[model samples]
Target chain A: MEKILPIGEYIEKGINSLEQNLSFLWSAIDDGISWLVENMNDLFLAIPFVIILALIAFIAYYVKAGNKMFTLSGLKKAYGLTIFVILGLLLIYAMGYWEEAIQTTTLVIVSTIIALILGIPFGIWSAKSNTADTVIRPILDFMQTMPAFVYLIPAIFFFSVGNTPGVIATVIFSLPPSVRLTNLGIRNVPGDVIEAGRAFGANENQILYKIQLPLAMPTILAGINQVILLALSMVVIASMVGAKGLGSIVYQGIQQNDIAKGFESGLGIVVLAMILDRITQSIGSKK
Target chain B: MADDNNIRIKVEDLTLIFGKRKKEALELLNQGYSKTDILKKTKCTVGVNKASFEIKKGEIFVIMGLSGSGKSTLIRCLNRLNDPTDGRVYFKEHDITRDSNKQLLDTRRTEMSMVFQKFGLLPHRTILENAAFGLEIRGEPKEQRDEKGMKALKTVGLEGYEDQYPAELSGGMQQRVGLARALANDTDVLLMDEAFSALDPLIKSDMQDELLQIQNKLHKTIVFITHDLDEAMKVGDRIAIMKDGVVEQIGTAEEILTDPATEYVEAFVEKVDRKTIITAETLMFDNPIIVRFKKDGPKAAIRKMREAGVNVLPVEDNDEKFLGYVWLEDMLKLEKEKAKTVESALNTEVPSVYKHYTVEEMLPLITGHHHPLAVVDDEGKLEGIITQTSLIIESTRFDDKEMDKLIGEANEL
Candidate 1:
């Protein structure tokens, strides 16, 4: 009522001090991420698009058909996924935004990988210790539910504009599912089985590696699927803060009131997202 | 305590109280409070109360009680799966209670292993891999562990199931994998806590029999826990009956049934099939009336039968070898004819039983026989005689007073 809370000023003061003291640290992170994103995009573009198509198609086909390559039923089952992948990749390549799509793909891949590396361990810690779980749960909730746009501010302050901030924001938005689901998976493992492990003199590390992690694989895989999808969704929002790729194309198209450009570039993003999503989801679901 | 050298595991005054107020509960227990009273006052359940016993090597020491009895907790203490609130457990000469984590792990991996009630096999793992879990944890090489695991699987009659997942097996088969897992560790002690309680009666019986057969060959010191009195009788060399977390009595199944130490124990054995537990050696009469077939005449046999008030006298050679029986009526007729030895009047068709033959087994032999059945040792030496009346009386009453008198008479053993 009387401006008793000056929460925004307090945050601004903190941010100013952090930026003044940590500029060196921020630039280093910024340079490292930018280098990573550029190289990864260049690598994606350098690979023959046809080989990439073939790889995706091959993976999609095998997801449907297992080791039985020559079997008629397996072939019949494989054709659907293979054709879908091929068509999807061909459409994205034919679109004039192939390079931008590849750039977006690189950002998504890099962001998802980083998110998982941090999220999985956090999840495992939360699952194992009640105190860690209590402390982490609210933080994870904040990361997931705080507006994706709000994240760009701090992400930019920390790493500056470009793919680094975009990747940072994407990681923040997508990280919660991995942490939450990994914790769920490990916690859901039957207690008696764990008791059995302890009964047999299985040490802490042995129990985690042999019993907990293996049993939790499918659920962790599902969490990874969610992370990838969330990172892809952040592509357009990331474009608002000077991120590259399909998101930037769509952003310009909207500014210019060019409906055709916007929808076409947006379609390219959909095609890419669909291919990656189907592949990852199938991996988790595979027997 | 019987022989120090052969004691595999000795638990001394072990108490396990389960709750936050363990110290208070223990104090109340020490002050002679009842278990329920302790629980009411401190909100602590006494899992085991000053349970003390010695498990002999190569014998099945069963801890038996109903659900909520401290049997499961007591067994867990042997492996330190559940640490005691008080007292100590000794393995060989070492105090297991004082063992460091490394020593306890070594004990679990090399000296003792446990089987669980729920079959605790990993559903994701093959039967062989689950069986080899203990070995793998203890740092056995993959090849050696697999070989031992496979061998252990065969021992538990799960050879063909080695590659299959636990979900593929029935409950009983899953439990065999559990057994094989412990067996693969090659430990001397096997602590089974309600290991077969989850199985149906028929499968449970098969597992029990198989356990006994395996025990016969391996001779591992097994501490088995069961809610079933019958199973305790079937598997145990000696049993400790528990109630309200206190050990009621520890003795052989026969001793518990024939001479229960507490009312709670008596309640548990009330419906138990007595014939399966009462053997000829326990029910037979020692120093029975007998006619010497080598030198005694029919008149001597008649007089012996008359004095003993028996319809027949068992005929034994001078060597005390069981020959047969002679009917008192036949001996009288033969005596009137002045027959020399009782051998002519001997009824060699009488049924006989070994000393260890159970009353259930003796029932079929005793139905129509007028003469008593000879209870003999392996060498056919007459140890005692079991009459149908003694068999029926002892089997029906299921008490020790009659057997006590007979045992008192035969204190020579």
Candidate 2:
């Protein structure tokens, strides 16, 4: 009889070796990630609901208005978008999922911000050099296609199952789109425009900041939007590993077979996703 | 060596090769491999090959060639926009090719500015902001940059369009903004790479005239690139014709028209409207037989006319001023009437055209007058003479048959 390969066992053993050897590194990352998530979650929860709504409305208005001056016409131009954000946030509060919604929002914002900060440089590096591109491209592809549940396993092994692991898994899961799109946006800056920049004696840094970055902003924002959406989608999956959010409420309802709670929590996550999506879309659409 | 003070830029043996195997390409190039062969063996594209030239200060030196002839690449090399694979570029005393990044940027900010074929105006920027781009890049203060930008915009006739975005403007307006941007840079040298080629023909001509007007006032040393020979001839004080990454010829419009250096150059010059391009100086015979009134008698003049086999002889005064001409018939009549002096034979009612007058401008004088025209300098000194025969010979020198052959050959180029 043909022998079946024991690939799963080998992976488990290899992971065991890594955990045994890299315990200090793993604990350091775990501690830092925990400290960050706890503080962000606490900060988000501490903010009054009214203030959060005002902040979201302000962001919505700012993006929709385009010009920074808040004239009557500008406010009128932005009112539709602001109203949608207000209604979505108020609905989450009315359903008694305000705290869970805030926790999820905190998770999405924290992971996405960290991921983008890391992703953009990787993107620029990948765009600028062929070696970085060759090395980073397939690694990004692997990170993207690997199951989110699979990220949780190694993440749990390292950080040991909580919001820390949940945030880490979410970050890993959502990072590829940001990196890929930023790379694409920068690479897509017109060759003639880059030549024009160089011809005008702009240095590499100046060209990147003044020419490439401004022109690539829309695409980069689109990438950030993708990262946010991916992060939100991971919240429910993350709750299985003891992360508290609207995802935990949904998970609790599912486990208890309470359809009404499940539906309400599910609706809350959708509302948050819609509001974030529209605001980011508005930002990305600006010239 | 004596023209060193006037030389704004000099490029020596500049060569550029693209691809990963540039070393191999260079080796093959040194061994005399053709560009195609080098490309085949090393996967490299040769951009410019051994291009060398000098642009004098305040002169519009145009580099012209069809696409892929490396004219654009050679111009870029002058500013080190494309770091040449091998060789040096000298902008006045500074060896720009050897300059550090900071020094190069400094030179670009201060001494050189470029206008691009695509207009290269930032879409996100307003027209005024686009015009201010160069000054902004130089870290100039906002108030000063905007003031300078506004002045440049006014120069380009784009005054009211300052706050408008680039997209809101037309193509010609965008190019005007591009010109404004270059002007606002306040550089001594302007490198315009097909700056007007993207515009329609009418707009291109207008821009070309506007550029000449600007040059007349500002006297900025401009290195203009174009595929259109007409544009080159119109604007260039001296034009460098390029082919296959090499400079084929460099000369003024008349010099290129009268004496093309190669078959390719001859073909390029063949298509030029000689009536517009060839001036009276080009068509004039510099050493026409003349009888100086103080030096020669009527007999000597008749003898000279008979020996030279011409019906008309231009009569110059003792000061070599073009007094007029003496017709053979008139001279013979004077001789028969015992007129001792050639002055009696001289017809002072001679048609005169300035040496700088284009043949097209001299056509009316040529058609209305029976006598050959004398080409005189500003002082009315006899520079040369232009007869109808000379005009026809110079204008139709490229016969239809020869032109067909040149057109056939130009197609290959």
Candidate 3:
């Protein structure tokens, strides 16, 4: 092969120079994300097992939109999703992967929150202005379609191999759905309703806050559900960068060639993912 | 024409062009090009062309035309929902066309509110919240706004529907909520852009009646828009008739019907179902000649009928209350029977309609009955008699030229 394209070496040389000069920027981000992930894991560990179980059950009730789970009739009305969450949490405990599962849950939650905080406003900006939409659309396409492993390389280079890099990689992998859906939802609002808001003398901000946001909420929540699922899938890849979670258990089992260890941990991850997915999906379907 | 001070809103040469490049559209309009021609040339629609008219305070001033006549666009311009391309609108001489955004918002919020054709209630909000939307935007406290909303709901007869969403209601009920939303602002003027056109006929008629009843008490200045000519004739105090974005005439319903200013207006009014516009009040002869039942014997009854050059005389009691009617032949029969008073011949079974009833309604009542229809007041006091002769004269009153030639032929005969 002719060495006509030395694009890889050029990119490597450029990244090396950026790493040296932007050392301060990378460290600041590393410190912030590491601190966020650390305290969140510690908080989850400190809570007693039964209390956490009860709390998850309570949230299940709330998101199921006031299903009275205490009574027998209410239990039927509480739906299969809530029952699955309760059983899934117990199964993870029985498998003795409670701590690992919680670590994974913390990782997914933090990445999703950060992704949404950035994504929703960008989405709103995209919906409101043609220039912003034109500029942001291809950037979102790049983030979404690039391989997940490719993100870990840059994330590890910046944050230097920890759960912080994992969080960053997961955030990068999961962000596009949140942004795309929020934009779609807002754009899909009927024009007459928006005109009604304007015709009633509602200022631009009032129309956004009172009419558009409330109407778009269900679709935004659906975006959140997708973000959580994408973050979970990316966390397993993020384990390659020394991130602690159930992903490490599966990685260790694979490296050591232990089928029993791999199957148990993989089953634990499935249960945890199912519980989180159903609850988030249920909340979006409320009303 | 209202007094200067009594005019709630006045538009002066106001024009609205739908597409961009309004200068070209106005130029084309100035050249006397038709609206379609301007649209084809400039890809811009002339929605309203130099529309100048006044809405009297507390009057239901209707702007009416067929679909695509720009009646809806014209009404929207009053509230600046669609800004005009040229000229000015004055809401009490404030020149709203020159208002800043903040000034326009204040004008919309406090002075003039609107009702839309689609019943533009926010789907996410409860009916109460939607009704209180204008008040909420004005920064009123929630409790105060809810109180006003409740009162407005009561005015629209939607009192118990406060907690429901708009989608839960029927279209007519939804439009009433829209009306309540506008009324909750307590504005001096209401801009109704074909507010009842989305509804079916029965509900639309009910809504129109309810609006009139509400106006009877509130007396708010209402600028109504409708494609239906019958609705305009029913509700309008005075009407402005539009065609191809130009207001062809502005006059009372009678003026528009009898003396249309333009040939376009004449053709427009010519299609209107005249029975709906011509009420019994117009057809009735007030204080119609009568024979007193208490005083007139058969002989006197016959004498009164002979003097009046009529075969029938409506008999009234001493209290001026209508008793019945007597025919000259019936009195002659009474004389044959040697009856002294015409009471034996007085027949009280004739159908009587209230004064404002339309001829459309009277047609069914007139069927299978040989006698005249009595026009009465609320007190059953005889206002007039709408005999078959008067009905025939009134029905032919629309085309004066044709009517005059027919009368000329009859006189020649």
Top-TM-score candidate index: 1
How well is each residue in B335-362 modelled by candidate 3, as lDDT tens digits?
8898878887888888889977877788
Query: Whose DockQ is higher: candidate 1's or candidate 2's?
Result: 1
Model 2 chain A weakest lDDT span, ten residues long: A68-77
For model 2, the stretches where C-alpha displacement exceeds 4 angstroms are A1-51, A68-79, B31-33, B40-43, B291-301, B317-320, B334-349, B397-413
CAPRI quality of model 3: medium
Worst 10 residues of 1 chain B by lDDT: B398-407
Could you tell me the lDDT of residue A108 within candidate 3?
A: 94
Worst 10 residues of 3 chain B by lDDT: B389-398
Question: By the DockQ metric, which is better: model 1 or model 3?
Answer: 1
Ranked by lDDT from best down, the candidates are 1, 2, 3
Tell me the lDDT of model 2 at B281: 74
Residue A45 lDDT, candidate 3, scale 0-100: 97
Error of 3 at A243 (Å): 1.5
TM-score of chain A of 1: 0.96
DockQ per candidate? 0.72, 0.61, 0.51
DockQ, candidate no. 3: 0.51
How many residue pairs clash (N, CA or C atoms closer than 3 angstroms) in each of the candidate models, in the order given?
0, 0, 0
Per-residue CA lDDT of candidate 3, range A157-251, in tens? Answer: 87888898888888988999999889988998888788777778889899889988889999999999999999998867878898898999999
lDDT of 1 by residue, B71-178 (tens): 888898998989999999999999999999989888888898889998888888999999999999999999999999999999999888788889989999999999
Indicate which candidate wins on DockQ: 1
